[model samples]
Target: MTATTIPTKTIYAGTGRRKASIARVRLIPGSGKLTINGLPGESYLQYSPNYIRITYGPLHTLGLDKEYDILVNAQGGGLTGQADAIRLGVARALCNVNPEHRGALKAEGHLTRDSRVKERRKYGLRKARKAPQFSKR
Candidate 1:
């Protein structure tokens, strides 16, 4: 008997981190729609460009100027941070889904992991950047 082969599906997985927040994502090709546990997107839609666009920036990349419907579960971030984290997670997943899209997303710096974070204040410093009230004698 001849050997039969089945095509493998491309799947992408990525994690998003910002400050103390993080979003884990698994992406598959489908009608874009975002569903976040208790909070329905209807209320959060205004917060995010789109379910999948959160990370892909689908509108910017595809240039369709529209958002896709997708399901998402995010935690650890505020409305804005969660949105950003979701975007990161989704974008990373997109890279795994298709290698070709990497260039497009990377060009926009979406794929790059955001390393910037709040700096720790040093001893005798009121803040990370601000020196304790300087008083000249």
Candidate 2:
């Protein structure tokens, strides 16, 4: 008896961060579909067109929107931060699939991680840098 071996699909992975959010993304060769935290991206993103568009920026830039499937696990931060993190993760995974894509992705600014986070509150201050109001007696 002869045994047949099945081929396994290869997956490319990337990690991205924005503010306090982090996203781990995987790319597999398949029909265009995006899932986040085990839910369809559109549903997970609450059908927000803006978010959907932002999340697909890298794919759209490379004209490969319908060529791959994306899976993402994102945590921390707010909705906007998560969306941006996913975008960066997708762009990185695309680059991993093809290093040549780096130039394009870089030019599109998807490779840059936004580092702006909430400022930490300082001691004896109302806010990060604001001070309590004072009046001379």
- Candidate 1, position 57, lDDT: 71
Report the lDDT tens digits of candidate 1 across residue range 17-76.
766668776554445545555455556646545543554473367452333433467777
Judging by lDDT against the true structure, name the best candidate: 2
lDDT of 2 by residue, 26-47 (tens): 8888898999999999999999
Full-model lDDT for every candidate: 0.61, 0.91
Candidate 2 backbone collisions, by pair? none
**Model 2 bad stretches (over 4 Å):** 1-6
